[model samples]
Target: MRPFLFLGVRPEDAPADDEYDAMLRCTGLDESTLRRVRLEAAPLGVVDLDAWSGIVVGGGPFCVSDPEDDKSAVQRRVEADLSRLLDAVVPADKPFFGACYGIGTLGRHQGGVVDRAHPEPVGAVTVELTAAGRADPVLGVAPPRFGAFVGHKESLSVLPAHAVLLASSPTAPVQAFRVGRHVYATQFHPELDADGLATRVEAYRFDGYFDPTEAADVVAAARTSGVRTVPPVLRAFVERHLHPRTDSGSGRGVLRDEIGAAQG
Candidate 1:
């Protein structure tokens, strides 16, 4: 079985590691089966999509809606690297799951309007599944309505024409969507539990998701909200894509051959 790749853009080591651990817990994958790539530390060089069962991108402090001039050099590099990688992931319809910042990266790559028009504060929000979401193989694992943690400065204001709306909240209309058969993105953090959200509230206290003075209140609310169903969606994705048949003519097998040949 191939390992699943997790791309993280958090520059801070403490929060980045914590996020990875949280993902491991949520997805039921250990370090051996789940690999981590800190994109802030280095460029995302040639990635073989076939080498992993699937890909999971973690959220970070970077906002895609920020002006190009205001973006740090690292942010620009990370965006460029992701664009290059998505060039392969999207067209091939590879299995992918993105949370929070992941929505920005994937949405922007798919020509969606990612802006600050629907920013949600650092707390739990009730996410309701759409008709399509209720039928989706991965998202269907979640209830039609459940709470999920969210704290972001930007969202998919306009979903791409090719994307199917999945779960939504009252505030964020495009809370979750599927691009193809396997690609998915969510504006909420499915990997976050009460303790995980509280850890991030402290780590990013001054990052402007909310007023620094309100961090404690945000943490308290997160602890009380009881977000449990969202994590199962992530687990379902891992279970579904963890083993791809490598026989000839299969999608994963063809992708493996193409990527392997390109790399060689």
Candidate 2:
């Protein structure tokens, strides 16, 4: 079995480690089963797709919708590297999961409109799965509606033609989506628990996710918010598709159905 690759974008030590730890917990993967790489420190070269079972990209401070002049050189390099990676991942239809910043990356690459037209505040928000989402194996067991932690400066204005709308919220209409059956992206943080949300609130308070004064309030709300339905999606990814896929038709049959059933 190959290890799952987790690409993190945050430069801050605490947030980076927190994101990685949370992902590992939700995916039900031990340290040996997962490999984490920080994109903030450097750029990634050619990634051998077969070397890993799947890819997971986490949220970051950067925004794709920001003006070119406002983006630093590091941001440009990271975006370019991710584009190159997606070029490989999308063609193979490999299993890929991306959170907040990951959605922007995948959306921009697939020609979807991503902008700051709908910016959500830092707190728990209601999300409802769509008809297709309800039919999806992994999401079938999820409640029709649930709370999710979201705080972003930009969001997907419209989904790409090839993408399937999975979950949606009043503020962020394209909360979650899928492409090519195996690739998924979400605007909300499925890795967040109450304590994790509070940690991030404090870490990013000065970074514009929310006003410094509201940190206490945000933490309070996050602690009480119910978002237990999201993590199963992460565990499903690990259990359903963690095996090495060498043959072209490897992940297309019973295993695919089993993956969905495993989630339910």
Candidate 3:
């Protein structure tokens, strides 16, 4: 089976590793099955879309909505790399999952307006599935309302043309959206659990997610939140698309039995 590609933009080792492990846990993919690529350390090379089952863009401190002058050279380079990758990934309708920073990357690429108008503080919040979301094959597994970790300096202020909105929150109306048939992005972190949030809260205390003085309180809030339903979405996504396409067509049909089994 092809490995899943996890593209991480976080430069800090501690936070990056936490995001990696969190994604692995959520996707139920062993380290061997998921490859981590850090866009901060180096620019992305040619990506053979067929080489991976799916692509996941992890959370990062960089915000696309930031003023150009405020962004460092590294951020600019990473943004360019992601844009180049998306140029390939979107048109092919590749299975891609973007969380937090991903929303900005994919949204911007798809001609959506990303801005700081809808920033969410670091913590857990109840996300409600939209009508389309409840009918989605993968996200349908989620309950009507589920807790998810959200911390972002920007959001999709305007969804891309033709994108399907899957989930939303009062604070962030475009919490989750699908660009093409298979590409998905979320403003919240489905990979994040309580412990992982706690770890991030500490590691990124001074990164402007929240006041450094409130780190402990933020961690406490995250530790006690009920977020059991969120990760299953990730697991379902991986399970649904694990198989490569056959000569016939897209391989989504192969997962019907598994999906029905889960639904049953």
lDDT digits (tens) for residues 1-264 of candidate 2 = 798999999988898898899998888897777899898898898899999889999998999988999999989989999999999999899889999999999999999999988889888888788987766654443556767788899999989999999899998889889898788898988787777777778788898878799899988877666544353667766666864334232223442343343224
Q: Name model 3 segments beyond 4 Å from true.
A: 244-264
Give per-residue CA lDDT, model 3, range 1-264, as digits (tens).
999999999888988998898888778898999899999999898999999999999988899989999999999999999999999999999999998999899999999999988889988877888888876766666766667889988899899888999999989989999876789998988887778788888788888889899889998877666554263777767877884333232222433333442223
- Candidate 2 residue runs with Cα over 4 Å from true position: 243-264
lDDT of 1 by residue, 1-264 (tens): 999999999998888988999899888899999999999999999999989889999999998889999999999999999889899999999999989999999999999999989989888898998988877777766666777889988999999999999989999999999998899999999888778787888889998889999888888877767664353677777877875332222122222232222112
Backbone clashes for every candidate come to 0, 0, 0
The 0-to-1 C-alpha lDDT of every candidate, in the order given, reads: 0.84, 0.82, 0.83
Model 3 TM-score relative to the real fold: 0.90
Best by lDDT: 1
Model 2: residue 38 alpha-carbon error in angstroms: 0.1
Worst 10 residues of 2 by lDDT: 247-256
The C-alpha TM-scores of every prediction are: 0.90, 0.89, 0.90
- lDDT ranking from best candidate downward: 1, 3, 2
How well does model 2 score by local distance difference test? 0.82
